[model samples]
Target: MKLQYWGTAAAEGLPAIFCRCETCQKARERGGKNIRTRPNAMIDGVLKIDFNADTYQQSMKYGVDLTDLKYLLVTHTHSDHFYPNDINMRRQGFANYCGNKTMLTVYGSDKVMASILPMAEAKSMAGLLQGVLVQPMEKVQIDKYTVYPVRGVHAAAAGPLVYAITDGEKTLLYCHDSGPLPDEVFAYWKENGLRFDYVSMDCTSGCSPMDYDAHMNLERNIAMRDRLLAEGLADGKTVFCCNHFSHNGAHSLYDEFVEIAAKEGFITSYDGMEVEI
Candidate 1:
């Protein structure tokens, strides 16, 4: 599986729009990997993880053909990750490209459906957009992959989710915007004998202290990695990536973050980064 990270920042992004903090200032000074947009990723150019606000910019920057995208898996209704308004652009008058014939199926929780269904139903999006409500732990088949979503620790009311996907040969665990998951989630993975080839985790808090349960910090990610290895959920060959950064994080500048993450055996994800496993 080829997984590409289109954007690797949290909601505010690196070098946040209005902030002038040290981290943001350094991020502005150090472009390249330090420059990040909201969180979003794609697998093999067909399945997208989120419809971030920066989708347009990411598409242009990476030369991605957004119209050709077939499947979308949303984590939650957070505007940074799930921008339902843009999905409307695929409608008749807005887009008349040949790629429009490819139906885009979005899978997410009921809250995700609630957010997009209203707008999608407002018009005749008939063949353009389709929303599927994905329940926790229920396997959903998407083309060549079997996707299993587990409820996340964030946004209880929104029914947030993290996904585990496998295409028979390789498996991926995409976890973000949440703190350490519940024990049951891990047990489910063990019970099903699902081992991951690639693991993408949230590092929103970066080098800062992880005082809350909403998002994870670097320490939490490291601990999670150890646990995954210890529990046989991931082997030494599994690629672990730290993603979803924030300007508020300390020592989160790309170079510094990469140096630290490399020592901890993690790939610090950058915008437009692609990895094959």
Candidate 2:
């Protein structure tokens, strides 16, 4: 399995759209890892996580052929995570795409389905759809992949979801757009002793010590990692990577995070970061 980090920024992205913060300023001056797009990822060119507004730019930047995607797993209905209008591009007559009668399975929580349903209604392409299909949460098997939808703790209105995806040999925990693990999720992990080969967690707050309602700071992330290790949820074989960083987190460069997380046994994810498992 191959995991590619398409975008690694929080809501506004590094060098944020409007602000002139020091971090954004530095990111503008120095590109590379400092540059970030909205949050999204691709797994083995089959499963995609989150459809942020920056999807187009991410595809162009990484040379991703979106037509080949088999599944789109949405975390929530946040503007930065799920952009409904952009998805319409995959419909007929919008963009020149390939794939024979390609059926794109989109999975998410109830709110995500609600958000996507209206768009399909307005466009009236929901009937003649050749490339997309929206599937609500359940343990669904699509294109040789088994995905488990877990409740996510985030916006009450959005009703978020996190995923545990398994493509036979390896399992990945696509945990973002969420806060601390809920008791049920913890119990599931505890009872099953299910270990993830790859973990892409939420580190939107970066190095802040402040507590956030739906995001994790660097300190919280480290503590969470320690807890995971102590509970046998993670081991040396598990590759832990952090993403969804905000410009407000203070650190401007991705290398800085790599250096910091290295001391604590985490791989800091940046745009275009890829790992083969």
Candidate 3:
């Protein structure tokens, strides 16, 4: 499986919209990996995770055509992660798709489905969108992939979800938009005999200290990784990646943050990073 990170920044993005922080300034000055958009990922060009406001820009920058996208998994209804309005763009008036399958199936929690269903049922977008309300821990089969939705500890209203995907050969744990997961989550992994090949975690706070449980810092990231390793959910061969950064985070610049993360054995994701598992 080839996993591509389309965007790796938090809600505000790197070089935030209207800020003069040192981190944002440096990101603007050094505009390569530092210039991150909102967080999102695509697997093998068919399955996508998180459709945020930056989707359009990320698509153009990465030279990806999303008209044929088959599946979309939304983590939450946060505007930065789930931009429902953009789903309309795939309708008849906006896009001219040549594929036989015109409908794109989206999976998310009840709240996410609620936010998207009404708009998708509108006359303009009726036949182009399909919203499936998936409960936490529900594993669903989508063509060649098995997607397991895990509940996240963020946004009560949003009911955020983390996804574990496997093509029956390699497994990827795409965990984000939440802090450290509950013990039962890990227990479930052990029960299923699940071992991940690639693990992408939340690093919204970067190297800073956070008092909340909605997001993770670098320290929390390592702790979580260590726990996963000790529990046999991840091993030395697993590729651990830290993503979803914020400009306000300590050592927020890509180069600076990566140096810190690398020392502790983690890959700091950039806007257009790709990994093969």
Q: Using lDDT as the measure, which candidate wins? A: 1
lDDT of 3 by residue, 1-277 (tens): 9999998998888888888999998999989989998989999988999899899888988898787787998889888888887887877777766555467889899988887787678676666788888888778887799888788988888879888899999999998788889998998778777899999999988888999999998999899999999999999999899999988889979989889999999988998898999
Ranking by TM-score: 1, 3, 2
Ranked by lDDT, the better of candidates 1 and 2 is 1
Off by over 4 Å in 1: 98-100
lDDT (Cα) of model 1: 0.88
Give model 3 RMSD, 1 decimal. 1.4
Give the per-residue lDDT digits (tens) of candidate 2, residues 1-277. Answer: 8889898888888878998987888888888888888888888877888898899888888887777566788888888888888887766688554445455667777777776665556453444233233342456676776776677667768767777777888888888877787667766765655677888888888877666578887777777677777778777798888788988885635867778888877889888988997
lDDT of 2 at 66: 79
lDDT of 1 by residue, 30-107 (tens): 788999899998899888999978998898888888887889999998878988889888887888865547778899
RMSD (Cα, Å) for all candidates, in order, is: 1.3, 2.8, 1.4
Per-prediction TM-score to the true structure, in the order listed: 0.96, 0.89, 0.96
The CA lDDT of each predicted structure is: 0.88, 0.76, 0.88
The local distance difference test score of model 3 is 0.88
Q: Which wins on lDDT, candidate 1 or candidate 3?
A: 1
